[model samples]
Each structure stands twice: as structure tokens, then as C-alpha cells.
Target: MKRDIQSFLLYLFGFLLLWEWLRPVEQLTKTNHIEMFIIFILLSFAVTFLRLRWIWRTILKLWFILFSLNQFHYQDGFFQLGWLSSLFGELTNNFGMIFAQNWAGLTNVFRTLLFFILLWLMVYLVRYWLLNRKRIFIFFFMTLIYITVLDTFTLYSANVAIVRTVIEGFAVMGMLTYFRILAKENVTSDSLITRKWMRPLVLMIVFSVIVGIISPKFAPIWPDPVPFLKAAADKGGEDKAGTGVGKVGYGADDSQLGGPFIGDDSVVFQSEAVEKNYWKVETKDHYTGKGWIPSGSTLLRFGGDEVIPVFPIHSRVETRDESAALHHFMDYTHLIYPAGIQRVQFERSYDLEMDSTKEKIIILGFDSTPIAPDSYTVQFKVPKYKASDLRQTSVVDLEQINTDFIRKYTQLPENLPERIKELAETITAGETNWFDKAKAVERHFSSSVFTYDQTNVAVPGENDDYVDQFLFETKIGYCDNFSTSMAVLLRSIGIPTRWVKGYTGGEFLKYSDDERQRPIYEVTNNNAHSWVEVYFPNQGWVPFEPTKGFTNNVSVDFTNEDGTPAAAETTAPVTPVPKKDLEENSSKSKESDTSFTFNGIWLSIITFLDQHWKWILLSFVMAGGAVGIMYRIRGKWIPYLYLVQFRLKKKDENIGKAYLVLLGQLERYGLKRKEDQTLRNYARYIDTFFASREMSKLTDRYEQYLYHQKLPEGSWMESRELWENLIKKTIA
Candidate 1:
């Protein structure tokens, strides 16, 4: 009975592990995970009760494969049988073609098979440990290490479920060990030891559950620097490289610019500021026809004690000024700054360059090589732009332009099509002023002439101009395509412009009620954008919006001085803030409920104690009773325990202790010998009621031990062993 119970528990444990792998059962079945787990456990119990032969076990395993295939379509109810048959027929009919056509499906099938194989191996291992009880502790420790390693890499699950499963696994192993120990001994079952032994295991489970509930979720402070893991992360980061979730590649010579838009909503940073503003990461003057790259400059190194970088701006006033405190959740090397930043404050010092012309700050030498700051604050002056003011400004004169400045901003590929230049001229034909011309180009793109698309953007072929391809051929692309084309077209007409890359002003989240009481906004990769910055004669660089769905930070006034409303103009609406699915958020919260407040945890503990005080007190009383019973039995049991210990240590010197134990057993059953009886007479008397051959052997050995005066050196030891064996046989 004990062995059978142990076997059943082992099978249940294997099913539990298998269930973890099969999780998220709602995806596979309409049933909830808890219901599925219960059903699986019941199924395991039924399988164990079958007591199948080895061949039947193999057949059962084969049946499991069919059952799994069938269960995948089980949601169809009675129709699943027909669907399975059809699926099997399809597979058999076009085995080779199906393998070629559905390679991913085949891979999934193989992966499922491998998962089941691993589960079967775990069950086999448990069975082996149950039979070889001496090695069970070593296996238990190894299994624990294996499970811990698995939990480290895998996503966290419901804490209660995880803790419960882990504790149950250990408890099941301990129970098996106890049963195996009992099976090796011939003593009658004692409920006292069982009750005492279970108390600690139960207490362990209770404590573990409480700790799991109250533990904070684990997150690494810094990224893993291990080579293989880093490599894997780097590979995974490729798709997210240009996107906002991980890193935005500002230092790359040519950004890999085009791909299907995959949106990421993971908050990389949150900024507390007075109003929304563009957070610039970096800028590049040189466009390599493929992407942007920085013009190489000499390094400016700052010592460890140097001040943080700051850039001054003359165009934007310091009034209505504000500070942005950026809290980073992801590592970033390039510090993000808002436009018109006057001073920057961070924990560390770095060499800085203030480009007053571009209104940009460059970090040349950070005190620490890689600047992975958790948070920083920037004090910036917000731009106060009115369209009337921009309309009044004009372009810089040709002779006033320095040769280097003209060469840099007006630079274009020699192979650029004349049609692109003509297109720019045609678009701005009615506009004479440089500001109006820039506005015309911006308005032309922002209108329905070009469509905004992310997934349909084309990758230019070698020798093909990307701007030309976007303008004339596609007429539909994302922000990079629109911004690049606008910059290049404006430069072709002698209006100098530079392409800028950065994230959009993120959506306002909520207000923080700290000392500052500022608004917080979450910024992610999907907010990454590119736009054109047009350089005016004396006003320095000004930003323009060319994308269909974006509005740049340029403030526009449509009213005239006569107090009459200006004409209604159509403009792109602000981009919608990406929202998370409610179901998904709920599921995540349920799974990740690891964070526990002290008050909440203490309340739970108090509630649990209050509810279960009766059971707890009863357990304590039962434990005390078991201890008292053990004390009472010490006189009889202690000597037997000492004899067993002696036999274990000194194998050659039983000293008739085993025979005396056997005699005690028989005497308890009223088979005591008469005091005056001879050995032969005693044997004859026993033979009348029971078999006497075993009794005769016991008597001869006893006689030799007591009266043999001329015995050999080891004769008493040999007689003691023989007497012990015959006494056991007589008692049985």
C-alpha cells in the first residue's frame, strides 16, 4: 500500500511539471488553467490505478500522443473527431508537401514532443529514486537546483501557484522517502512518528507560501554582461534597435531605416516637465543617401571633476521656462535633452560642447565611459514661435553665407534627378519668400498628395536615391521617408536644411505630486520620429512638420490684428497614444502580483492566523502527545534502536541481540519456555504444536554457546548467528 501511494504521488508530481510547460492552457483550451490542472491530476490518478504492464505502459504513452493531438481541437466538442480524421488524412496524403509548406507547424509539433519526452524522463527519475531510497536526498537536491535554474530564465507565473507546486514537489519526495524507510523495517506501523515527521513539512509549506506572497518582484539592476546572453539579447534587440523600446542608434554610420512598423509600449523613460516638447537624442548633418551620420570632430575630454554639459540658445527666451526631470528605465548612452536647454544636471560629469548655432549639446567624455544614468534633470527654455514672426524672417544672402556652411547644408548627391529639383520649384512657384517656400513644401507633403504608411515603406536599391524613390514612385511612406525627402528638396532649391532624428513629445500620463508637482509623460520607441530643421538667416534653426499625422513644436497664429478670426486650416491631429489591452493588463497583474506592501502582508498573516488558529493549536497538541508517547516507549524501543545501531557498526558481533528480540516477540504471544526444561525437551514440546526443525536448530546453537568447553575460536560467534536466524524462523 505504501509503495503504491508513493508511485501515485510521483506520477502526480510529473504531471504537475508537465502542466507548467503546457501552461497558459486557455490558449489551447477554453478551460481555465486551474480546471485543466485538476482534470490532469484526476487523469494521472486514474492512469496510476490501472497498474499497466510494461507493454501496456508503452501503449499508454503512444495513446498520449494521439490524445494531445485530439485535445488541441477539443474545443469543437463532438465535431473534433471528424476534424482529427480530416487532419490525419491531410497529413498522410501530402506528407512531403505539408512538411515543406508548414515548416513552422512541424517545428512546433517536434517541440511539443520534446517537452513530453522530458516530462516522461522526470517521472522515470522519480520512480528510480523511490526504489533506491538511500540516494533520494542527493536526487532531491539536484532536482531543486534544476528547477531553480529553470525559474530564473522563464517568465514568472502566479506566485501562489508557483510556491504551492514547489512545496508540494518536496513534500511528495519526502513522503516517498518515509514510506521506503518503513518498508525496509519489520516493525508495526506507528502513527506517532508519522504525525511528528509531517508537522515540519507542513510548516515549511506554510512559511514558503507566505514568503512567496510577500516577496517583491525580481528585476536586474543592470543588464547581464555575459557574452552568450548578451549576444542573444543583441540579436533580439536588432528589430527594436531603431524602435523606441531598447536603443535608438544615434552613433551608427548609417541607420537601418526601413521595416514594418512594430510598436513597443514599454516605458523607457518618464519625464516631468511643464509642457510637451521634443526630446532630442542626437543630430547628424551628413546624409549618406542611405541614412544620417555625424561629421567627425575632434574629441573634447572632461576630467572627473568637470561640470555637466549645457548649450545656450538666443532665439528662444528664458521666460515661461521649465525643467524636465527624466527617469530612465532602460540604459541609454546618449543623454536625451529638450530643445533650448540652458543647463543640464546629472549625477556624473562629462566633457561637453555647446553648439549655439544648432542649439545642441554634445557629450564628448563622460566620467564613466558609458553613461547609463537612471535619471537626470534638464533646464530648458521653451520656444515661443508665432507664424507671423517666422513669416517676417528671410533667408541669409548668398555672399553672406560662408563657403563651409554653404557646402555642408546645400550638399546633395550628384546623381540626384533634375525632376526632384523641378518638383520643389513647381511646389513653391507662387511663394517668393524663403519662409513661404518652406511652408509650401511642408504643406504639399502634409496634404493628401502623400500618404503615411509604415509597413509599406520601400528599401532603396543601390544607386537609387531614397528621397527620389519616396517622392516620385511610392508617394506613401513613414516619417523617415517624408522628412528626408522634404530636407533634400528644400536644400536643392538653395534653402539650407538639416535632417533631425528624435522622439516625439510623448503623451501626458499623470501628474506627480512631489515637491515640483509636475506632469509625467511616458516615452517609448514607437514615439521615435524624424523631421526637417530649416536654418533661417539670423533666427538660427527652426523645425518644420512634414509627416501626415505629426505637428511640430512650431507655434502658429492664424488671427490678424483686426480681431477677426483667420481662415480655418486643416492640420494633422496629434498622434494617438498607444494603449494596452485591458485583458492583457489584467492577466499581467494577476501573474505578476509579487509586490507586497508590509501592511497588506501583515493583514493577510493576521487574517490567516485568525481563520486557522484551531487547526494550528490542534497540531501543537498532537505533536506534544506524540512526544509523550515516544517517551513512554523509550524503555523498550531504545534498546532495540541501540542494537540496530550496534549491528550497523560492528557486523561481526551481534552477541545474540537479534535472537533475544525474536524471543521477546514470541514471549508477548504467550510462547514462553518452562524454566526447568532441557533444550531437547523444549524442542519436543514446541514440535507438538508447531514445526520443530527450526526450534531444534535454535536449541543446538544455544547449547553450543552455553556449554561447549572445547569450542573453536569463532564458534560462539557462529552459533550466535545461527541461533538468531532460527529464532526469527520460529517466531514467524
Candidate 2:
């Protein structure tokens, strides 16, 4: 009984160790209702522990899984089969996706089932190791590695988890080791001996865990590797190579483009604006194919009261004056201003520097060093464009206005692929004016053909043009890909376009105490994004969002059939803040609820798959390997199970069933029962190994049962004790 208690404790700790792995899934990834997975795991362990028949255990687990799924999708009726049709439809589509290697296309239900299967397999492995091998160190070690990796790379804080895992893991290993020793030495089970071994083992685990907890932890001697790995992957010119997508903040390098990046939720600044608007840091006129680079720069210094000249409002376009106050969370020297930015207001005397060619503004301190002010107010104009005015404005007007400006903004790398130009020309063949041509190219990237992805993005090779690869080959990437490709495609078609870098208007936190102005908005590193600004001599630079699932909210009036401007101008939808923040914000408001529901679920599935699909697939692979091992090592362990199972039997029918079990154990133990050998002959060969005649005695009655199909009434009691003795001796 004491041994049973200790073994249960060991299994309990193993379950706790596995629980540490699931704890971070919901908080760290986009996976929802992780509590369902937790409940499933607990049930799996419970069913296994009851030592029920395999068929019964499988049935219970299956029903519980269906119950959980019903809660998620069939809430209209308790445990309804309403989901079966949906399940079959999604399953067929997903099977096609798997065949095509489109892992991301898998639905949420498929991912959920895959995750449950993974947990089920893992729990089974833990049970096997604990009961058969009396060891769990491998799993414990793996749990440690898993926790540490997640804590380092993701937002999951494994500090408490690590502590709990360490205590649980060490305790499990110590107890399992004790069981292995007891079995190896053939020690007698006694209350005093069990207490003697267990107390010290418990104390050792407790002492080590306490020491580890209290030990002075030094600052991480090395920097975080996730950012380092990201920077290294983005080392070349995937814009702001040094500043690259390392931690998702604004980067300064635009020398190269392409590569994968992770999301960073760290806040960069907060702004109080009348409405959400795109904030620009700079524009790059030159595309090197790999990434953006600024062209020849001309500097202009001005005071707060001066009119800012970056993308000035043209005489043809209508505008309204608007101002925004920005309070930064980080010390960034560069200014992030909205379109038509006129000037900046500061409490202290300061100067603003503008690289007119790049349209980048910086705050200048007393020493002329670029310094970030804690707070500043920017005044800008918001243009309401007219269809008649913009559509009538042509490239002829732009070239006539400033050939130098046209030449500078329309620059593309000389080696840019010919196919890109062909594709761009094909996309915008019918559009005569720059605005229509730009719009034509913008509509080309639809969600049906392209996806907005951050981590799975590809880097352009030395011979590969970034825009060409994104447009023709991959068709999947984030803002950089969409914006750069748009800029390049427009330039290819002779429309002057420059790449613009900036932050999208951030999430709406809440209304301020006064609640008079717009809601408070907090922008994070994840908001760092890029878009295309097509230059029309009359309309200045107009921002366009070619990235699927995002909009720049550029207002444009369309012409009616009568050729007059439409009564009301159309404002594009709000910018979908690229990665994580948008998904989180959309879940709150009923106004946005319907619009964002699918996107929210899709983002969550993507996020979880992004970090963990490899593990889920691998769980099955490891499960296969475990099965092969179980098969090979069956002989070393199968007899003990038979010994335990038959020890409780009393039915007369158990005599024949128990005899067959004895034969199989003997065969597995290397005393193969020859086909020609009589039962008595096999029994005599078995008796030779352990100097026991009990097998012969059991076999004589076994022959009576095998031939007559019944045991002699009093002979059965004698045969049972002899059968138990011989089976034990064969294993011993």
C-alpha cells in the first residue's frame, strides 16, 4: 500500500510537470480556452490511473473531447452533433491543405484536435515510463528545456513555472530512482524501510529546490538570443538592418529588405489626436530591390511658427487644419508626424531639422544634436481629395511641375527584374493617370491570393529582387513587402512613388478623464509599418495600403457617371495595426465585434501555429518511436503486468485464460514453447530454470481443462496456487 502511494505520488508529479508546459500556451500565444486542454489532460491521467480496459478508457476520453468541442462550437445544444457537418467539411479542406503542404490553412478545429492528440500521446508516454521503466528524468529534462525556451522567446513568464517544475521534477526523479533501486536489489517492502528511504529523498529534493530558489540570480550574462537571431537573419538591408525587426521597434536601416520577424508589444509612444491617423518618420525614394534607401538629402531648419513643407497641400486639393499632441514612452530623436504636417510646438526653445528629400524630421537640441523631446504638439492638414481633381492630374503634370522631383521619386534599381515591370504594366494597363494606375496596382494584392505574414516571410537573394519575389513568387509578407512592392511596381510603370515608414494609429485604450477629445492611444513597436506614397504633381504624396487586410484611411471622392464629384467622399477603413495589437483590440467593442471576429480567430490560430506547430507534429513522431521501443522491450516488462492482473481472479474460467498468459510470458522470457512440445513438456522445461515443480503441477490440471474444457472441482484450487507460483518464478 505504501509502495502504491509512492508510485501514485510519482505519477502525480509527472502530471504536474506536464501541466507546466500548458500553462503558457494561452497567455503566450493566441490559443483560446486553454483550460479545455487542461481539463482533457487531467481526465486522460485519471482514466489511465483507474487501470480500466483500454476500450473503456478510450471511450471516456473520446466522449470528454467531444464534450469540450460541443462547449466551444455546439453551445446551442448540449453535446449536439451539429458540429459533425462543419467538422467533415473542414476536415476535407484541411486534408487537401496538408497534401499541398499548406500548414497555415488548417482550421481551428483541426489544430484543437491535433493539440489534444499530442497531449494524449504525451500523457501515455509519461505513464509508460513511470510504470514500466520507473524513470521520468527524460521528460523532466525536456519540460525544463521547453519552459526555458518559451520564457526566453515569448511573452510567457516562466519564473513561477520553473520553480514549480523544479520542485516537482526533482521529487519525481528521486522517487522513481528509489523504485528502480528497490526492484534491482530485490529489497523487501517494509513500512520502516519505505519511510527511511522516502524521508531523506523528500528532504533532499526540498533542500535543493529551496537553495535554487534563494540563490542569487545574476543579470543575464548574455543578451536575449531571439532578438539576436532575428537581427542576424535580417543583417543585410531588410531596412534598418541594425535596427531591423529585432524587437519590432522603429528601425533606422532601410539598406536591405526581406526576412522574418516576431512581434514586440513594448509601447513606443502615446498620442492624443482627433482621430486615428498614420504617423510618418521618413520616406525613402530609392529602392535597391532588396530594401529602401534615402536619396540625396537637402536639410531645412525651422522654428515652431513656420509652415512645414513636407508633402505640402497643393492648390488643387482641399484640406482642414488639425493638430496632435504626442507623449513618447521612449527617447526617440525622430519626429513621427501625420500627413500634411505643418509645424511642431514645444514648451522649450528647440529647432526642427528636415531632410527635405527624404521628408524625415528630427528634434534638434542646443548642441544641434538630435534629441527627443518628452512631449510635443504637431499641427498638420488632413486632405479631402476630389476625384475630378486627382484623376485629371497626370504624370505630365508631375513631370512638368518638377522633372527633378519626378526623377528622384520614380527611381528603381537598374537590375530590377524585367518580369516585375511586365507584371506592373499588366496590372495597371488600362489606367491612364497616376492615381488610377496606383489604385490598379493596389487592388492586385487580394487576400484570396496573398497573405499578411511576418515570421514566414522570405529574404530576397543577391540575384533576387525583393519586389519581384514578393510580387511573383511568395505573395506573402508584412508591411515592408506590400509597401516596397507597391513602390517598386508603381515606379516600374513610370508613376512616381516613394516608400513611407511610420506607425499606424495605435489601439484605443480609453477616453481621457476630461473625455473631450479623442480617446488616448498607445503605439507600440508592433505599430511600426510602411506604406506607399504615390506622387501626383497636384495631389502631393498620397499614401496607399497594398497590404492585404489593412487600410490607410485615405479619403478620395469618386466621379459620378455625370462626371461631377460624388456628393460624399469615401474614407478607407482604419489601418489594421499589423500583428498582435489589432487582434487584441478588436475583441472588445461590439461595433468592431462582427467585423473582427474571423480575423481575431485566424490571428490566434496563426500565432499558436507560428510558435508550436513543429512540436505538435513532432509529438506524433515521438509517439511512433515510443511504440517501436515498447514492442522491442516487451519481453523485459510484460510478465509483471500478467502477474498482477491474474492475482485477483477467482472464476474457474480464469484457469484456462491464466494458463495461456503463463505460456506467453514463458515465450517472452526466452523459454519458447515449441509447437510440438506437449503442455507437460513445456512445463517441465520451465521448471528447470527455477527448480520449481509448480508449473508441472499446474500443467497437469491445465491439460484437464484444455482437453475436457473443465477443471476437476477440488483440483482448481491447487492449480491456481501452482499457476501463480510458476508465473512469478519465470519473471524472477
Lowest summed lDDT across 10 adjacent residues in model 2 is found at: 231-240
The per-residue C-alpha lDDT of model 2 at residue 476 equals: 70
Cα misplacement distance, residue 41 of candidate 2 (Å): 53
Write model 1 residue lDDT over 51-166, tens digit each, in one string: 76767776677566556645653445443476566656655645565657865555333444444565556556655555544345555455455444444433333444556457
lDDT of 1 at 102: 62
In TM-score terms, candidate 1 sits at 0.44
TM-scores, in order shown? 0.44, 0.50
> What lDDT tens digits, residue by residue, belong to model 2 across residues 153-224?
665788988889888887888777778888888887788987898899888878888898899989874434
